[model samples]
Target: MPVDSKLTASSEKLIPEKQIAGKLLAHYDRHARTLPWRAPPGANATDPYRVWLSEIMLQQTTVAAVIPYFQKFTTRWPDVSALAAADEAELMAAWAGLGYYARARNLIACARAVVRDHDGAFPPDADTLRSLPGVGAYTSAAISAIAFGRRAVAVDANVERVVARLFAIDTPLPGGRREIDAAADGITPDARAGDFTQAMMDLGATICTSRKPACGICPLREDCAAFRTADPAAFPVKAAKKAKPHRTGHAWWIENGGDVWLERRPDKGLLGGMRGVPTSVWRVAGGGEGDSPPDYPFAGRWTALSDPVVHIFTHFSLALTVHTVRAERDCMAGRDGEWWPKADLASAGLPTLFGKVAAAAMREELPCP
Candidate 1:
């Protein structure tokens, strides 16, 4: 079968599709990474639930970072139905420190969607998988090919780099992404599409790395255009990045008796649906911490700590001023969130930003048991 016509027109490079797939597959049989979500070489595919879960957890996250989380999630929820039935707050808590709060939200939505719309079975077709929550083009393709053995083009960051180098496409990223997609379609084989996609991923991760690709040992080196140029690392040119805008906010540590007041952020924006200490709105500043601190709901004499809690997000950098105040039980009456025991703050599942604030407060004031 021919490649996607729309992408074909934009493709900057063409290769021997069958030969490339065969070489990569042969290499994969001997060196496939022993990941929990994947089947061993020549084995039948693993569970779709495992494929779906691992793909979600791996988004913008590294394998080293995701392994423990994946194990924890599978151990706790087991399957789509169990995940669908999980309490939202508890699930969000379990996902704390995972970063990318939106993915956690979509994880819930996607699990519920799989159970509700597809009868707890993920759809086998890539296009159909795209309809599920959090399953975008790359993710849908990965799941369809890897889990369901469907013929689909899966182009992730790793695959993108490998293809960019193999073809030596010079167009910088974003603009070149379409060309990469087309090139990927050109190489994806009809049989063993899952294994082929995975081989490309493994090749890119272990060999075609960004900075210093090990071209001498790479299985595809002979077929690689950039390798002929002797500078495989120079391919996949990227546009320069702009400086991330700075933002400032204040996290209030309202401790009463032995407990602290914490609230769930609104479920529509950053850090949504997670338990955290009360925080003022986060706004972009030209530079430096913004003019002054935001006011809190409860009234008390506030003690502002000197060191700020700093965190870097995708689009912005944030510096939160930490404030602490002891309050009477009545002062927090009718508040919107729960008063978590200060000693068991670890169980509160605070997002990283708020967790930092809590740590800062505890360091200077009360130490947990």
Candidate 2:
């Protein structure tokens, strides 16, 4: 189906795409936000590595949360070659607090791929960029436009909302994304595709916000379908979200001498490839009296803590019962994990869920290990 280019005005006349683009670009020149990963407007394009790294870190995360992480990552691994050569454990440790461990794992893979396959430089086109690990359509398009000056439509959540409101797209999201993308493609100017993309992002983040949009100051207000109806915020309608499921599990803290038992999680699954204490399988149907103690790594008197550590993931809520026990020095001597010192657990780089469990276990008086 063809996109209706006509604005929602009673006249129903087509708004020139160039006029919208020009107005937006003009607004961008004055109001573009200064970000650590972005070059100033009209400046030379940003490095593809920075663009790619920022995009990955920004996924399902806010800019404020990503800023320090981006700074730390760039400082430690300044370029693709350095990132490619980084030790996996050290890299994951640096990425510990950043939720979504998969991104960190994929970051390592993508960095190595760029160094090995693309000669330590990112591919300049969207299709080629998408071939890299963890680089999806939105990320590939963002890198292609912002890093290599390609004419690509980089529609992130912000751009999606802006386009949805601009066109008064009533279709609920995921389905409406197609119309939003088409509308975005229509306004994407031939020149400064990078700047245009950023402008749309800035407009959405600042003026055309999700809640109360500042339509009076919006550059495209005259051409906006939602604004014509005096209900700009009503657009970008979303479908009702399903209630997230709940699950329960257990983490055992076994201490001997000055070390605690910590094992590396399997290479695939939730919290994969990270070091954590032994835990029971987190399942939906096993929360109440059916929740039984998992097999202990070594025989010892186990004591369950009073409070459970509750953490929320994207799909479900997890309640982790923490159990602690003191064992002999030689207990589980040939186990699959190392005995990490209890004092240095903070630096052990446990994921947030395990970290919470560790904290809950530590509140009780136990032999220092």
Candidate 3:
């Protein structure tokens, strides 16, 4: 029997779900990417801790960037109970270079929740898993399916692209997400659901890539609506992006005898629970005007530096001017933070934004009086 080369638009002409699943599973059996977090095909399920950790770290971050961090975290804290028991500061420092500091905070909270509520075992069902901190729909589904062998559809960006192309969904995302999820649900097999989900992810990551998808060798090419149209990459249509808002602020660089002033950010909001230099509050333009300067931490001989540190966040861009000051040795006596040795700034666990600020200060060689 021959599969249809061109699928009709009618309901009866929809691509056969079994054929797509069989072909994709066969391809996965041969070409699955050997990630540190995933178990081998037909092997026993992977540790739930590894699965959950990888999923959280991989959010809005590339796998290549996450590999070392994942290895470090697992080596340091192998199990949920260990992670739950770890100190918050140590965990935040370990996660310093990894952006999205909020995730680190939530990771600790979720770990503690798991240890307290679930006895250090992650809930096996998707709905129950979502109740845990920071675990959203996609992550919950992924954990349930991959870690517990439950029948669930875990659609990440990769799987979204693959599904959108498979069905030739022209509606732009997030609008198209519903249709993509539906299509994914329809094709997901009753058995080996975990492998099927991972297979879809692998296919999207390796073959059905966002740019120049290898449609010729794709397992589901015959059933792919986008492949038949000769533009498989045009799918998972996205809405036009609005320009990110820009903001400007200042960071005080107060140094005394080879030590700099650093403070711990509040345990809530942006850069939460991380160490950084004192700075102005980030503000949006009001009535088409720049914001007023924030109050200084303490009066000192402050000199403005020409260079500014520019950092981009998920929702806004920041330009922080560095105000160098030679604070008297006694001035910082009552301050809440430590006077960290300048030589050891690398280990200060500054968020990437503040790290850039430190680099700018170093480049200018702001002398201490």
Q: Residue 304, candidate 3: how far off, in angstroms?
A: 2.2
Residues 1-369, model 1: lDDT tens digits: 366875753452343877789899999999999998899876665799999999999998999999999999999999999999998888999999998888889999999998888999988999999998889999999999999888999999999999998889989997999999998898889998889989999998899998999998999987899999957798899999998888888888888888999888888888888889888877777545435756876767788889989998889999888888888767778878888898999888888888889989988763221
lDDT of 3 by residue, 205-297 (tens): 889999889988898888888988856788989999888888888898888878988999998888899999989877765536656665777
lDDT of 2: 0.87
What overall lDDT, based on C-alpha atoms, would model 3 receive against the true structure?
0.87
Segments in model 2 whose C-alpha atoms lie over 4 Å from true places? 1-15, 285-290, 293-295, 367-369
Q: How close is candidate 2 to the true structure, as a TM-score?
A: 0.92
The runs of at least 3 residues in candidate 1 whose Cα sits more than 4 Å from the true structure, single-residue gaps closed, are 1-15, 286-290, 366-369
Q: Encode model 2's per-residue lDDT on 1-369: one tens digit a residue.
A: 335433344234454677789999999999999999999998765899999999999998988999999999999999989999999998988888888888999999999999899888999999999999999989999999999888999989999998887788999988998898999998899899889888988998899988899888898898888888867788888998998998887788888877888988887888888889988878784546786656666667888788888999988998888889998767867778988998999778999988888888878877433
Q: What overall lDDT goes with each candidate model?
A: 0.87, 0.87, 0.87
Give TM-scores for every candidate, taking all chains together and pairing residue i with residue i. Answer: 0.92, 0.92, 0.92
Evaluate residue 327 in candidate 1 and report its C-alpha lDDT on the 0 to 100 scale: 82
